[model samples]
Every structure is written in C-alpha cells, then in structure tokens.
Target: MTKAKRTAKKLHHIDRAMSETAAAERQSGPMRVLAAVNELSDQPPLIALSAATLAAGLVLRRPALTRGGARMLASHLLATAIKTAVKRSVDRTRPHSVDDGYDYRLEKGGSRSHHYSSFPSGHTAGAVAVARAAARTWPAHAPAAAVSATAVGAMQLPIGKHYAGDVIAGALIGYAAEAAVGAIEAAVLPAMTRRSAS
Candidate 1:
C-alpha cells in the first residue's frame, strides 16, 4: 500500500483502540452507577410502591388514590407478564454480546437465559406501565411521567442491556397493558358501584 494509505489505516486502528478503552472505562464508572440506579425500575420496588400507594389510599379514605394505586399495580403486573412471555418466545442477543454474531430466534424454543432474552426490555416495560397508569389518573403530570419513562428506556441502550428495537417494543407493550387495564376497570367499576349502591 502507499505511504498515505498506511498512515490512514494506522490512525483508524488507533482511534478504534481509544474508543474501546473509553468504553471500558465508562462501563466501570458512570455506566455502572446508572445501571445501579436503573435497578429501581425492577418489579419488587415497583410492586411495593403500588401497594404502599394503595395502603395510603385506604387509610386516608380516598377513592381516587385507591383507583390510581390499583391501576398502577395492574398495569405493571400485566406488562411484566407480557414481557416475560415475549422473552420466552423471541430470543435476541444483547448488544454487549453481539461480538459473536447476532443470534435471533422467534417463536422457536427461545430460552430465558439473560444473554438470549433481550428482545423486550423488562425495565422499560415496567417503568412505562407505571408511568402510563399514573398519567391516566393525573393528566397534569403526564409530561413528567412520560419523560421519566422515556429516560428509563433510553438508559437501557447506553448500558448495553437492550437494543433500540427492544426498548421500543417494551414501551409499546407497556402502553398496551395500561390501556387494557384501564378499559377493564372502566367496564367493571360502574357495575360494581351500582351493586354497592343497591
């Protein structure tokens, strides 16, 4: 190769090496911190928050708060269940594990192994579900809730926990779960109210 071409090739390799090193450092520092905070979106804490809101609503005798809590709980549960089912049925390798060629299998004996279960992000699903549920109840806070939920989903990208498509799918699943839960509540609550008044 010509001298100019050799120089350009060396520079490209050097830049790639620097980028890899930087990525390693980031994962050890800010990325780790972010991932840790992201764990708050997990099922246990979310479920606890829902139950606490429910208990507070009951103790304070507030029907709106009670309904909000119930909606949040139901939405999160449904989202999680849907996410789990999708993970089991559609397998996709995580971003970090893509070095060994991308492995994607849909509806073909997909396993729940962490590396292979990266299709629909569970964290994003739960966060979006809770956010949607809260927004449905308090329309004034919808913007803030949406931003928070989007942040949770976006964080998964940098942390190498999910692909963009996975996050998008997760958000859709979460929204649908909340919508379904809301419809069910709408149809049943009035009938139950009528019965109680009888």
Candidate 2:
C-alpha cells in the first residue's frame, strides 16, 4: 500500500480505538462533569456573546479591535467553507455511526446526515480561525480568544463525534486560513484605504 493509504488506515484505527475508550469512560462522573462543562460553553447566550462583545468594541470606535473583529469574522467564514468542502470530499463516518455505544445525550435534533464525513470539524476550524485572526488584529485579546476557541472545540469531544486528532487538524487548518487572510488583508486593504483617503 502507498504511504498515504497507510496513514489513512492508521488514522482510522486510531479513531476507532479512541471511540471505544470514550465509550468506556462515558459514564464516569468526571467525564460527565466535563461533558456538562463543554455543553455549557456553547449555550445559546454564550454563543452569541462573542458577537456582542465584538460589536461593542466596534461601536466604541476602537480601530484595532474593530479591525480584529472584522478580520476574525472573515477568516472564520472562509475556514468554514474550506472545512465543509474537505469534509464532503473525504466523507468519513462520524464516531457515533461507527460506534453505537458512544454518548448521544447532547446530540442535536435534525442534525444533517453526518453518517459519512467527519474529518475536520467546522466548529473547531471556524473558532480557531477566528481566534487566530483576532490574535493578529488584537494581540492583547488573542489569548482570551484562543481559550474561547478551545472551549468551542472541546464541545465535540463528549459526543464522540470527532477524535482529538480531528480537532487538532481543524485547528491547524484554521490557523493557516487566518494567516492567508492576514496576508491578503495586509497586501490589499491598505492600498485601498490609501486610495479612498486621497
């Protein structure tokens, strides 16, 4: 077998093993507690809270922060598009479908057919992408944004929807996307702004 195929097979095996381990630990009180915490991280209000914070920063006319917020938003959307395309292309089965023993407590109703296609998580990718963008725009807030992004990423763990490796891959993708956006913004936006000013 080719090296790429071997690596794919290895990842599949590792994913299966991790799924089984998560299933084994599903009912442990600590696991339950952690799952609860992860769930709370994305509570409706908290999910919207980030936007509100960014909006407030913009309203206050904080140039650096407003720019950061805008950049983060743009990068996150771009990352989501890329992540979704890749997920569709790979079409790997989600952990839940692979192992019925996994937790289903917090599974969303009417979730799209995720039976196949669980490579990189859109949530993780978007969160990390925005976080990286935010870091570039506002270095002071980057650490906080990263912590928030991590919490968003952790939400996937308890449901056994994705392996830790998947989240890591998504984060890397997000970071790369953020970097690309920054480069484009640096190259294009300033020239446009200068023209508009003149």
Candidate 3:
C-alpha cells in the first residue's frame, strides 16, 4: 500500500479500538449505577425535594427544616446560574465526546450546545451547593454532606460527563454560591429580627 493509504488504515484501526473501549466503559455495571445516582442531582428532582422539605417543615412547625430547605433551594439555584455562566464563557468538550480525554478547546465564549459546554460540571455544582446548605443547617451532618458532594463530583468522571478539573471548579462554584447566600442571610436576618422586635 502507498504511504497515505497505510496511514489511513492505521488510523482506522486506532479509532475502532478507542470506540470499543468507550463502549465497554459505558456498559459497565458500576458506571450504570453511577449514572442513575447522578440523576438525583438533576434540577427537577432537586427542586421537588427542596419544596417537599420546606412544606414538611411548615406543616410540622420545625424551624430547622424550614431554614434548611430554603437554603438548599437557594444555593442550588445560585450554583446552577453560576455554572451556566461559566459554561458559556469557557468551552470544553465532554470527555465522552472527544477521542482524547485530556483534550479541550478554550475560546472567548461558548455556545448553548451541550457538547461544547463542559468546562464545569453542573451536576456537581448543584449537588455540592445543596449539600453545603444542608450542612450549614444541620452542622452535625457536615462531614457526611461533604463526602456526598465529593462523591457526586467524582462520579461525573467515570461516567464521562466531566474531568477532574471540571469537578473541582464546580465544587468551588457551589461553595461560593452557598457562602454568598449565607452572607446575605446573615446581613438581612438580624435586621429583620430587630425590626420585628420594634
């Protein structure tokens, strides 16, 4: 075969191998489980859970649950907004979509296309944000909440949704969102209390 033809044939074989590897990974039982668990972090379910917690708190007359639910919902929403902004600003292909796991494209801005918006993992951001809010309300569960958040972030890797760096950035965004919400509450709640007292 000519040099060009030989090169083409070799490239085809390499692509086939990569495709097989990717398919196998996707079919793994553990990965399937992870993918299912990741769905819990999705917006709809998270929102529903938050609303349920708040409603339960109201009905049971429990201040802690009321505060926890409010904070969880607010922080997750903030985190989602922050991640969406970041995804638009920084473009990177999802790991599963690219041949090279480490390859990423950075540009001035990104499109709304899901394929190119992978700089930060949205699922991880929301998960960590909700976890942080829960931990703040129930300080005793802080450790477990942190671990759960980390697990959610880590699961994004093997499932081919995001890279480690993406998860880390997402976690930071989550933390920032929660901190901002907490700060706002700290500043406003005391004033409201004083006003009510008067």
TM, every model: 0.82, 0.75, 0.83
TM-score of 2: 0.75
Candidate 2, run of 10 with poorest lDDT: 102-111
- 191 Cα displacement, candidate 3 (Å): 0.6
Residue pairs in clash, model 1: none
Stretches of candidate 3 off by over 4 Å are 1-24, 99-104
Ten-residue region with minimum lDDT total, candidate 1: 16-25
Which residue pairs overlap in candidate 3's backbone?
A: none
Q: Which regions of candidate 2 fall more than 4 Å away from where they truly are?
A: 27-54, 101-112
Error of 2 at 152 (Å): 3.9
* Candidate ranking (lDDT, best to worst): 1, 3, 2
Q: Per-residue alpha-carbon lDDT of model 1 for 4-62, expressed as tens digits? A: 98997687456334433433433668899988998998899899988888788899999
- The lDDT for every candidate, in the order shown, is 0.82, 0.69, 0.82
Lowest summed lDDT window (length 10), candidate 3: 15-24
